[model samples]
Each structure stands twice: as C-alpha cells, then as structure tokens.
Target: MQKKVNWGILGLGQIAHKFVADLKLIPNATLHAVASTSGERAQNFAAQYDAVHYYGSYEEMMKCPDIDVVYIASRHPRHHENTLLCLKHKIPVLCEKPFAMNGVEVEEMIAASKSNQTFLMEALWTRFLPTTKKVLELIDDDVIGEITGVKADFGFKAKFDESGRLYNQNEGGGALLDIGIYPIFLALLLLGKPEEIKAIASIGKTNVDETCHMLFKYSNNRIANLHASILNETATEAFIYGTKGVIRINSRFHESTSVTLLLNDKEPKDIFFEFLGFGYRYEAEAVMEYLSKDVIEHPLMPHSFSVDLMELLDRVRKEAGIFYPTYDRV
Candidate 1:
C-alpha cells in the first residue's frame, strides 16, 4: 500500500477551510497539520479537520518532520514570505495565486525553490479543472477553430471596509489581485502573453482599484477584453472566439463546471462535469501525483508560467496605475 501524503496548511482562512474540505476527497491525502497566527484558530481548525498537528505560528509548524507539503493559503501579500519560509526548510509548497506581489517576488520564490531543490507550484486550481481541460481539448481539436479573441470578467459587490483585506493596500487589497487574476489567467492560458496591454481602473476611497478594465492585444490581431470589479456583480463568464465557432464558459468561469460550444450555423451544445467537493481536489491530486514522481514543478503550472503571469499582471498594473506601496517598493 502507498503511504498517505501528509498535508500541512499554513493559513486557516476561508480559502484554507474550503481547500481542506476538498483535500478530504483525495484518498491518499491526509490533513496532517494546520497553522495560524492565532493559536486558538489553529487549534480549532485542526480539531475541525481532524488534523494530526496544529501550531500557533507558521515557523513552529515548519519544525514538524512529517509534513510532505505545505499549502500557503495566506493573503496575497504574505505569499512570498510564506513560500520562502517553506523552501528554506526544504518542504514542498503549493502557494496560492497571484503567487506573489509582482514578478520580482515570484522570481525570488522560484530561485529559492531551485536552490533548495524543493517542489513548488502556484495553486491556480482553475488550471486543473475538468472544464479547463475540456476547453483546451476542444480548441486543440479545432472545435473552436483558430482562436481569434477572448473576453472574460469576474466581479462581485464587496462590502466596504476600510481596514478589511479587500480595501487595505498594505494587505494587497484590490480587485486586480483579488478577483481580476481569474480573467487574466484565462487570457494567459488561452492566448499566451499579450503584445500590448491597455488598462484603466477606478481607484476607490481606500485607494485600491474598485473596478479594473483591461484590453490585451496579441499577434495576428487576437485580443482579449477582461474586466474585474468589487463595485457590482457582473456576468462572471468567459468567451473564446475563433474563426469557426465560439466557446462560452458558464458563469463564474473560474470555477465553472460547464462550457457551451457554439459552432457556426450549428446548434449550441452544453457540456457538464461532475466533481467531488469544491473542485480544489483536482489541483491537490495533481500536486500529490507530481510528488510521487519526485518532480519539482507541475508540468501544467510550471515556474515559467507563474513568472509570465506575474509579469503580465505587473504590466497591467503599470498601465492602470494600480500600486501597492508596501510590497511594490524596490
């Protein structure tokens, strides 16, 4: 029998809860430990998830000898620090996206990973979903023909709170990093890096982008119109247009379970996928499989991909004039 992969989660936030719930769906994976700045929260989370260990501080959790990998679910601003800590201990890591504050931080994390010879990957769950796989398969099979353009948006009205993570610049709060990355990821995944990027944003009272709009142009006239907002609820859908047809990822495209194919002069067909938990299991499974093979990086979500993604995000921020002084300073 194969040994169970022991998982350690570094942050006990809302996303960690959801990820732990999905982690339970993997047969060979076990919640070995959980850590949080608050001892009470860490204890509560460990108890709730039946984890073997819990630590009040992230540094304390790293002392554990049995953690096969640590999932860094901390806020965007702390991703670089958390990932570097894990790499220093030579522990494998699955850090949540945007990966880090910018391209520089991402490159630093990758350097640590390489120097330590530790496994590292960005936890971009959408990349491993069935819907995403199906979309890529269809495009490769010419179901969507030659891709011409892509349009995607993700937005929700967030409650205004000056000190909240969503509104605090020090916490890396902004629509672009919070929810905007979904649309940007879709564009990057489908169309590669843009040749030119034009962006604009509405900076709210808290001095963060409440709403951001981006237009990307690629070679051969391929373009992508992407938008993200915390001011109002938008359709939250993605469309990939091609010469022969178009493919529409259902609402909430980032975690969407279905996609509709619309061929020219043909009937629209809907495709659905069923999965256990909140669809995070796929990415977890991918990580475990790579670990079993002693691989350092995920083939699908490679280090170069994260670097390019962060660089593209930095470009967009430059064009939109969105800056996080705390982490952006050289």
Candidate 2:
C-alpha cells in the first residue's frame, strides 16, 4: 500500500478551517502540522485538528522534515513571500486563489519551484468541481455548438467595519482579488485567455475596489461579461452562451449543484451532480492524484494559465489605476 502524504497548513484562518474539514474526506492525505502567526492560535488549531505539530512561525513549520506538502492560506498580499519561503524549504505547495499579487510574483515562484524541483499549484478549487468538469466536457463535445459568450458574477454586501480585512488596504482587501477571481476563472476556463480586456470599478475609501465590471474579448471572437462587488449581492450565477444552446449554472458558480441547458428550438435540459461541501475535495483529489505521479502541476490549472490570468489582471488593474503596494516589489 502507498503511504499517505503528510500535509502542513500555513495560516489557520476561516478558509483554512473549511479546507481542513474537507481534507478529512480524502484518505491518502493526512494533516501533519499547522503554523500560525500566533502560537496560541497554532496550538488551538493543532489541538482541534489533532495536527502532529504546531509552530508559532511559518518558517519553523517549513523546516519540519515530516511535512511533504504545504498549503499556503495566508492573506493575498503575503502569498508571494509565504510561497517562496515554502519553496526554499523544498516542500511542495498548494496555494490559495489569486496566486499572487501580480504576474511577476507568480513567475518568480514558478521559477523557484522549477529550480528546486518542488511541486506548486494554485488552489483554484472550482476548476475541479464535478459540475465544472461536466460543463467543460459538454463544451468540448460541442453540445453547446460554437461558444460565443460567458456571463458570471460573484458579489455580496460587506460589513462597514473599517478595520475589518475586507475594508483594510494593507490586507489587500478588495472585490477584484477576492470574489472577482471566481468569475474571472470561470471565463478563463471556458474561453482560454482573453486577447483584450477592459474594466470599470467603484473604488472605496480604503483605496480598494468595492465593485468591478469587466469585459474580456477572446481570440476566437468570443466574449465574457464578468462582475463582482463588495457592496451588494449578485445572483451568484453564470450563463455560458453558444451558437446552439446555453448552459446556466446555479448560484455560487464555484460550488454549483446542477446546470441547465437550452438548445435553440429545444426544451431546456437539466443536469445534476452530487458534491461534498463547496466542492473543495475535488481539488484535493486532483492534487493527490498528480502528486502520486510526481507531477509538479495539474494540467487543468497549469502554471502558464495562472501566469496568463495574472497578467490579464495586471493589465486591468493598471488600466483602472488600481495599484497595490506589492506592485512595487514586482
């Protein structure tokens, strides 16, 4: 029998807790260690999850010989540095969404991973969801005929707490990098990278985007309409239009339970699939399968695709004059 891969978690935030809850669903992976900025928090996480070890600092946890892979769940602004540190330790990494603050940082991490022969991948959990996979298959089969457009939105009202991370500039709090990434990823998956892009956003007092409307033009003459916000809730749904039919995804495009298709002059067809909470386990399973084969990255979410997505985001951010402090580091 193959041995289980030992996993170390960096940052015990709310998302980390959700991921841990899903990690229990996989049999070939084991939670081995946890590192948090606070020793007290680390201890609490370790006790709650029964992690083998806890470290007050990430550097300490990265040095552990037993940890085969590290999951970086730090805040967006800190992802680049946190991932680089794990790469320096020669440990494989599965990082949270948005990859990094910009494309340059993602390139640097990719280079380091290649040089170190360590695996690295973005934890774009939606790409592996069952509904998404089936949708891709239908697109490939031309079930929707020639694809033409995509529409997706992810938005929710934010608490007015100025000190909260969602409203703090230093924390990289914004709709563009947070909820916006989902709509962007959906477009990328179906249309590949866009050839041209334009965006408009509502800037907040904290100098972060509270709402954004984006347009993507693909080389195949297809287009994507994407939107996100931190002020008001959206339908949280998606529609992929093609020449022959349309695919409508349910709320929370990332964790969809079913999809409906309507062909020209034909009745609407409904497709359903069962998935565990939020569909995070699919990504975990993909990682386990690829890691068992010693693959550095999964094809579904390749490093180049990540780089392209980040570059596109960089262009949009520049066009909108929305800059983060980490851009200087690039």
The Cα local distance difference test for each model comes to 0.94, 0.87
lDDT of 1 by residue, 1-330 (tens): 767999999989989999999999888999999999999999999999999999999999999879999999999999999999999999999999889999889999999999999999999999999999999999999987899999999999999999789999888898999999999999999999999999999998888999999999999999999999999999999999999999999998999989999999999999999867898999999999898887789999999999988988899888998989888742
Give model 1's TM-score versus the native structure: 0.99
The lDDT, on a scale of 0 to 1, for candidate 1 is 0.94
Writing each residue's lDDT as its tens digit, candidate 2 over 1-330 gives 757989899988989999988988888779999999999999999999889999999999977877888889988878889999999888889999889988889999999889888889999998899899899899999998998999999999988788887887677778888888898889988888888889988888888889989999987788999999999988999999999999999887778989999889999988999888657778887877777777778898889988977877777777666667645443
lDDT of 2 at 97: 86
Model 1: ten consecutive residues of lowest lDDT: 321-330
Top-TM-score candidate index? 1
Superposing all C-alpha atoms, what RMSD in Å does each candidate have to the true structure?
Answer: 0.9, 1.3
Which stretches of model 2 miss by more than 4 angstroms? Answer: 328-330
Off by over 4 Å in 1: none
TM-scores, one per candidate: 0.99, 0.97
Which of the numbered candidates is closest to the native, going by highest lDDT? 1
